[model samples]
Target: MGFVCNGRYVLEPAAADEAEKYVNLLHDCMEETYSAIADPGFMVRRRAARDESIEEFMEEVNGPGVRCFLAYEVPRWTSQGGLSCAVGADIEWDAPVGLALSSLGPHEWESEMPVVPVVAGTRDLSQLYTRATTHGTGLGEALLRAVLADDEPAYLWYIGGNERAKRFYEKFGFQDEGIFGECGGIWGVPHGEPGQPLQTARMFRGGVVLQ
Candidate 1:
């Protein structure tokens, strides 16, 4: 499935060959996100992990039961000499801007999740991210909608300090379960600062019947 959003981006199933582009986008987005809450040196420490994400990304993209979607920027056209240009005609996709990865099942980190009553048959939203430059252009929302079905029971984890992400999920009817857990390493960066373990909370939404 493919769709355009806000005349600025297009969403489509990610190609297996685009692992490098996907890793780069994820690195930039995560840096922008964690820089606000993490120590200044955190990104420096995360460099090796960021560089190594290509392998993991490739594995996941080609892994079983995983659906990965990518968003590409749309080319902008302008009229010449004050004439109207056929803006939407012959639209060309520019560059990759965002990505979302979802999976059914027992994810790699499921065992690490805080012990709680787990929801049965829930889809795991493993990742949803967009370049910081594309924020507010509805790129993130479009990518999210493309990955998960409406009224499908699903869950995702958010970093503790990322209020923006928490609020975004809330808009889609996901609620925080109040189960907090600490991750020593996230995306290959260790939360080594004393008393500052990487904080996380799970957010869930019920399917149609439960809703």
Candidate 2:
């Protein structure tokens, strides 16, 4: 059976009826982690509509090329209550070569750039509500290992300035691949400013051998 990690909590996957709980958990995690750094007002507005968003997430999760996992604590008989932790990953698809090429327009070229395909992954480890309680256990590492086991030669991006997260990724053998220049400009998201693109790092693990 698959397990989800939230500090000391480990939860098994249940039915969609528990969607609200998972959604709330995700909102909390996002709020604790990214909200302070980014726009908390925007996050609050989005979190207010999390129920509807979760429905969409469920649809996409059940769809092709997507996988979701949830973790919870197994309580002892005398324990107060149990909490949950959730994480997920999405498989990458080939965008049209034109689209990919267009996305990379006007970027400096490195002579020996490695084309490691990107896969999306997320975790809610920012919430310290339950983290302090669980210590020295390998639950977090175990969850990461599970995700890595499923996808070999996979890469993911982490926003810069999150030094703690950067170290976590490094422990898993991911290296810093530098910032993405055209991401904000091309997407029109306006993260910081026109020229100050979001600092990002790409980390890869495992190897794929071709016959």
Candidate 3:
């Protein structure tokens, strides 16, 4: 999918040409994200298990119905390397400060869907990351709108305690689907003591047309 976008960035679909660069950008994004809200213990474990995370990212990037749009800080052709096939502000940064990874979910979330004409199965906003330094810039918004315009009835698992994220996502119509308990285990964080709050929640948006 492609888009006609207006902003400092021109978004585009990522191609195999951007594969290695994407990996580099992805790690950068992950490091920033985990830094903000991840448990210290989990961070230690994740660094040690870095290879495992990299392998997972590779699978998702190549998997069914997944799309990645990179936000570039400069024009697409600024590189001697070839990413000629890329188009739209999936924003492409030669050293990207923002990335949005999306995938179409396998199952229906009919109960969760509203009247909007969203992608049939849920579209997962699997990862949305912007470098901390670009926090005030519209880089995140530009990257998000590019991906959302292409797919919707979207959902994501946002880290808890991020009021900024919650507010940002709410403006785009995502609603809290409730906190998730399994994230502690999923991220390799030790289970919280009884009644302790965990840092994961599911949020959902449209895709249910009620046909």
Candidate 4:
């Protein structure tokens, strides 16, 4: 069972049929959040590519290893309605979002050290973007906290140059692991001008272990 946040939304695990819908909403979050750093052409191309890859996206969300958590705006009286956001992850295999998705297994570093399962699509699931918004309501943090409210070690890929993301992850004790990657470059699809690559990095910390 889960509790209400923001006086209306319920945070809980997503249903089977709902996985695809969540992935679709991922586009909105990515576009809105990364819009400042990306050009219009890139956004358009990305959206189109995502739409065409719905099957692949759905497979990612519904993969056996993946578990999805979602936020929805249910009537405070009854529990049913608009799907607000979602976050999903797989701790077993390679995830469609470019994560190796494993814990206690081989890391990309060519070593056998155990790694933490990656939290997938959390940034998208933690954000609420309605047309009637005037400013951030801090509700995203609530959604994010719902999925990550744990002591077990988990990791995520934080994009470079995002101070807000850096600060948030820091609050959870996720520190830079000194591992760096490119936006699409990790998958060999580098964006930006030849010399200007979009870089991201790894951050790890023992679970926040909130008292």
Q: In TM-score terms, which candidate is top? A: 1
Q: Per-residue lDDT for 1-211 in model 1, tens only?
A: 4545534566778866787778777777788888877656666666656656777777778877787898876555222311123334344433577889987655557567765535444577889998888888777888787888876788888888899999999999898887787665543334465335567788888751221
Evaluate residue 203 in candidate 2 and report its C-alpha lDDT on the 0 to 100 scale. 51
User: After TM-score superposition, what is the CA distance of residue 154 in candidate 3 from its true location, in Å?
Assistant: 1.4
Compared with the true structure, model 4 gives a TM-score of 0.60
Global lDDT of each candidate: 0.71, 0.41, 0.63, 0.45
Candidate 1, position 10, lDDT: 61
State residue 112's C-alpha deviation in candidate 2, in Å: 22
> Residue 141 of model 3: what lDDT?
74
For every candidate structure, what is the RMSD over all alpha carbons to the true structure, in angstroms? Answer: 4.2, 11.3, 7.1, 9.6
Q: Count clashing pairs, candidate 2.
A: 8
Q: Output the worst ten-in-a-row residue range by lDDT, candidate 1.
A: 77-86
Assess the local accuracy of residue 119 in candidate 3 as a C-alpha lDDT between 0 and 100: 46
Candidate 1's displacement at residue 169, Å, is 0.4
Clashing pairs in 1: none
**Cα lDDT tens digits for candidate 2, 46-111:** 576776867955554454334344555443411232222222322121110000000111123311
Models sorted by lDDT, best on top: 1, 3, 4, 2
TM-score-best of 1 and 4: 1
The candidates, ranked best first by TM-score, are 1, 3, 4, 2
Residues 1-211, candidate 3, lDDT per residue (tens digit)? Answer: 3322233444567765566666677667766766656655655565566666666667667877877887655455333332442444244356766678887763343233232334455677877887787686677777787667743677777777777888888888889866444354436455562233345666777753322
TM-score of each: 0.81, 0.56, 0.68, 0.60
Q: Report the error of model 4 at residue 142, Å.
A: 3.3
Question: For candidate 3, what is the lDDT?
Answer: 0.63
